[model samples]
Target: MARAYGFVEYGGPETQQLFDTPVPSPGPGQLLVAVRAAGVNPADWKVRSGRRTGSVTVHFPAVLGREVAGVVEAAGPDTGFRPGDAVFGATAEGYGGYAEYTLVDARAAALVPESAPFEVAATLPVAAGTAFDIVEHLEIVDADTVLVLGAGGGVGSATTQLAHAAGAAVLGVTSAGKRELVESCGGMWIESGDGFDARVAATAERCGAVTAVVDLVGGDVLERAVALTRAPERVVSVADPARAEELGGSGITRRRTREVFEHVAALVERGVLTPRVERTFPLTEAGAALELVESGHAGGKIVVTVP
Candidate 1:
């Protein structure tokens, strides 16, 4: 039996528990992976709380997590992976990364570069992948000024780095504690909170107008970001798609493919992108890890490592 953490029902953190289960078997186009690491995200908790069940239906005792990295233990037909091959990608539907073993769709999986560790590779499929989609969708250019709300978080930090690498000026809106982190990621730090829009406007005066806004924090924050840019079409929200659409902006549409994963992994290998893993918890501490991400204050990414 393999150890796993998951929710027994649709509810709060109280619904989560650790238990033992048989190692999952992979079917056609799937790979059973010995999960070395898993990246924690806000979406995990959202799904657990039943706030985001439209996309994926949860079974009772549903495991949590979407991205993972590890060595393949077995491969199903047409998967093209063998035992001991290092790989990472999104978990298969109804499967979760927060376990000793999980299944990944081969089409969405990529070989982990020798230079990239499992922890770093584990972060790509979701956070870095979403950032990539946002940058590509906006077609960020050197002349453009990009504003990243919640810049200190995983996706925000990745987006900031990618936009900066594309020669765009990046303004990262984050809490005061993450000023150093935002600046280190090649962004000009703009503190979030009351007068956030004013502060962003003041910075824009010096750095040029924000040509695009990447909203990782939605609701009023997204409203403020939309107002900062004249091209509302360039505004994209990963948090609240409905609100973004109402404001004339669209939501990020992910390209969850192996090619995208390979590209992001290559960036990590070349040191062009850093996963910036803030902390790692053991499998037993997965609950705390999710709580940190759900709190919306985690800097960079939180990973759960398995022994």
Candidate 2:
């Protein structure tokens, strides 16, 4: 039996437990992989908490991870990957990658470059993929100024770097503690708080009117960010779709494919973007790693390694 960390019920951290799971078989267009690393994100806990009702089907004894970097163990019919190929991708079934073995859709999987390590590859699927989607949707241009809310976290950090690489000036909103981290990614840090809009406006006037706002922080913060843009439609959120719609913006519409994964990987290869992996935990300590993300104190990506 393959060991895995997961939850038997929808609840808080107390619900998480380690258990033995059968090594999953690959479905058509999928690859069964021996997982080396998995990335942890807020969505893992949000779904685990039962707060994101109906967004996904939760099978009890659910393995809880989305992204993985691993060696292929088997390839399903029509998949191009071979056994022993080094690859990374989003889990074909969202709840599987927390296990020692999981399946990744061929369409979402990519060959890992020789220069990229498993931990770095693990960070791309959700955070960098989502960042790419958000930036692509905005179609940010040279001379544009884009403001990223919650810029210290994984997605925000990737967004900052990718936008900066596209020749746009990046203004990042994050806590004071993360100012250096955000700035290091070529983003101008704006401390998040009350009157952040005025600060954004002042910054924009000095550069140019904010052309786009990428909201990784939702609710009221997102609502306020919409005003910083010249048009609400230029504001998009990954956090709050409902609030975004009310403000005339919308949430990111993701295109999950191997092509997208390869593009983000290429950015990493080119040194145009970097995945800031702050900490890694063994599979046994998956709960603690997730707790740090849930606490909202994590400075960057948190990864779980499989033995």
Candidate 3:
């Protein structure tokens, strides 16, 4: 039996617990992986809390975690992976990454680059992957001015770096504590709070007109961000699609492909992007890792490591 963390019902942190289960067997186009690291994202808890119930119907005793990096333990028919290959990507639905072993869809999976560590590769599937898609969708240019809301977090930080690498001037809205982190990634920091639009406008005057915004924070923040850009179509929100639609914008549409994974790995290898994993918790302490991500205060990415 493999040790794993999961929830028996839809609820809060209390719903998550550790248990023993038989190691999952991979079917066609799947791989059973000995998990080395798992990424913690707000979406994991959103699903656990039933916030996405209308869109996602999960069974009871659902394993919780979207992406993982590990060594392939077994491969199913039609999969390119073989035993002992180091790979990272999305986990199979219901059999997730917060465990000793999990199944990954071969189409969503890719081999980790030689220079990347398991922890860094672990962060790619969800956050970095979305960030890559967002940048591509925005079609940012060298003369464009980009604004990133909640820019200190995983997706936000990745967006900032990718935008900067594209030669766009990035203005990152974040807490005062993350100023250095945002600046280090070639973005200017804008304090997150009231009057965010005014600040964005002022920064645009100094840099260039705000051409696009990547919203990781939803609701009022996204509403304010819409005004900073030239057109609502240039404004995109990863956090709230409903509100974005109301404002003539839209949420990020992810294009998860092996090539997308390869692009992010290439960025890291070339030093154009960095996967900043702020902290790691042991698999037994997975609950603590989720708590940190759900609190909305942690910077960079939070990862769970299985020893």
Candidate 4:
């Protein structure tokens, strides 16, 4: 039997417990990864806390992690991967990853650099996918200025890097502590505080004009992004879809997921992008990882380690 993390109830991180289950097998166009690391995200804690509920229509055991990196243990005939290929990507339907072994769709999994550790590769997929998708699909022009809310988070950071690399002036809203990190991503920092709008305006003025905004923060912060967008059509929101729509911003859930996966895979391979995994916990301590994500204060990803 393989040890994995699952939750039968929704409350908080403490509800997560490890269980023994048979290892999963690869099916057609599928892969079985000997999970080395499973990165944590807000979605992990949100799902656990029942705060962002759904995907639980059927009553069955639920695997809490979605992104993973590992060596390919096996692949179905339709998949081109070899037994030893190092792969990283998101799991389908949020079923697994906090386990020693998990199944991933061949399309979702991409070959990663062998030199890179499992923990780092595992940090890709979700945030990078979301960031890459929105920035590419929106087609932010060279002269356009892009805004990223919650620049301190995983998705926000990735968006900042991808957009800046694409030639857009990135204005990132974040805490004072993350200024250096965001700057490294080529983003102009906007601290989240009383003068947040003024800061963004100043950055836009300095850049001559703003264009698209790939907003990762929700609530009032997202509203602030809506204010700086030079063109209404250039606005794309990765988080806070409801608020984004209310402010005439388009949603990125349509293309960013797949786009993020593809773009980040290339970036990680070419050494153009990097994922910061603040900490890693053993599979047995998956609950602690979720607790850190729940706090919404982790500087980088909190990954779950496996065999």
Candidate 5:
């Protein structure tokens, strides 16, 4: 039996419970990981709260984590991975990441850098992957002034790094507390408040023209990005699609995002990119971690560590 973080109801972190389950065997094309860490994203809360829908909508009680890093404990038939290889990747269907063991596609998982910690490598799947997708997929390059709304968060932080790597002039919007955080990723920051528009306009004015907008903040923030964009197609968001559509934007498709992940993984291997992890919780404390992530004030990322 394996212990995991599960929830019987859709609520905040308090609803999550530690439970037992049979350690699942990897099926064909799958690798079973002895999970060291799991990256906690806002999507975990949204899907659990029923705001986001996907192929693995919970029918029974479910786990709610996504990205995971650990060692390959077992490989299913024809899997290329061998036992004891350190790996990391995005987990699909149910939140198996909040456990000591979970199954992921062998092809999708990347071998971790020998020098990186399991905790840091664990942060890459969604944040780094999505950042790579947005910058590369959009072809943001030299002299491009890319506005990163909500740049203090994981995806936003990672996006800033990727955009800077391509010589884009990145501008980040964040609360005052996060100014240093965004700047470390090579972006200038705007504190979100009453004067947000003025701050944005000033930032744009200095950059000459806004070529792209990667909004981590949806709702009114997307509208702000829309107003700032001189090229609509270059504007992108990883937020609510319904909200995105209301502003004449669309969601990032899965296939294209894969290319971004592959490109970023190379940067990670070269030691040029680092995923900033804000906090780590035990698998049993997933509930508390979710609360922090949902509070919209996490310094960077929250990860769940399993023994």
Candidate 6:
């Protein structure tokens, strides 16, 4: 039996619990991984709370977590991975990374380099990968001034760093507590909250017009961020796609390919991007790790380590 943390139904934190189940086996083109670490994101709790209704059906007692790093205990046919290989990627059969063992689609998985730890590699698949997609899709250039909403979180911080490295001037909107974190990523910190657009506008008056808005926070925050940019088409969001589309912007389309994983991993290995893991919890404390992310106060990434 494998120990896993998951929700019994679509509900709040009360729905989450730790339980035991048969160790999942890899199907064709999948790998059975002994999970080393799992990265916590807002999506996990959102999916659990039923805020993200979609075509995907939820099986009761569904395990959460999208990305993970671990050792390959078994590999399915034609997966190219061997037992004992270190790997990280999105889970295959449901986002079930919150388990002692889970399956990963080989196509989406990447071998972890010796230089990077499992905890750090675990964050690459979702957080860093999404940031890379946003930067590429927006065609962010050095001349561009990009406004990053929710700059203190995982995807936000990675997006800020990638945009900054691309030569774009970044105006990061976050809480005053994460001011240093935003600035350290080569962004000019703009405190987030009510009247956020005003502060952004004042900052843009000095930096230049915001050519693109990479929104990690949706709702009114995204609506306001869109107003700052002239090229609303260049505005992209990960948090609220429907609203983004309604506002003339679009949601990020992920390229769940091995190449993207490799590129992001390379950047991390080179120290050009940092995962900025704020906290880690053991498998038993997975709920606490997720609570931090769901609260929207997490400074960077929160990961769950399985022992």
Question: How accurate locally, in lDDT, is each candidate?
Answer: 0.93, 0.90, 0.90, 0.77, 0.80, 0.91
| Model 2 Cα lDDT, one tens digit per residue, 1-307 | 8999999898888999999988888889999999999999999999899986677667789999889999999999998999999999988855567889998999999988667899889999899999999889999888789999999999999999999999999999999999989999999999899988889888888888888889988988988888777778888888888898889988888888989988988888888888999999999999999999999989879999998
What global local distance difference test value does model 4 have?
0.77
Residue 181 local lDDT, model 5: 88
Clashing pairs in 3: none
Candidate 3 off by > 4 Å: none
Q: In candidate 4, list every pair of residues with a backbone clash.
A: 129-260, 129-261
Per-model root-mean-square deviation over C-alphas: 0.8, 1.1, 1.0, 2.2, 1.9, 1.3
Give the poorly placed runs of model 4, Cα more than 4 Å off.
51-53, 56-60, 254-263
User: lDDT per residue, candidate 4, 125-173, as tens digits?
Assistant: 7767776677777886667688777888888888788777778788888
- Candidate 6 per-residue lDDT, tens place, 131-219, comes to 99999999999999999999988898999999999999999999999999999999999999999999999989998999999988899
Estimate the lDDT of model 3: 0.90
Best by the TM-score measure: 1
Q: Work out the TM-score per prediction.
A: 0.98, 0.97, 0.98, 0.91, 0.94, 0.97
- Candidate 1 is scored at a TM of 0.98
Best by lDDT: 1
**Residue-wise C-alpha lDDT for candidate 3, range 1-307, written one tens digit per residue:** 9998878888889999998878989999999999999999999999999988886657677778989999999999999889999999999766778999999998899999788899999999998999999999989889889999999999989999999999999999999988988998889999999887898888889998888888898988998888777678988888888899899888888877778888887888888889889999999999999999999988999999999
TM-score of 6: 0.97
Candidate order, lDDT descending: 1, 6, 3, 2, 5, 4
Point out where model 5 deviates above 4 Å: 256-262
- lDDT (10s digit) by residue, model 1, range 1-307: 9999999999999999998878989999999999999999999999999987899868878889999999999999999889999999999999999999999999999999788889888999999999999999999999999999999999999999999999999999999999989999999999999999999999999999999999998999999789889999999999888899999999988999998998998888888898789999999999999999888789999999999
TM-score of candidate 4 relative to the true fold: 0.91
Candidate 2 lDDT score relative to the true structure: 0.90
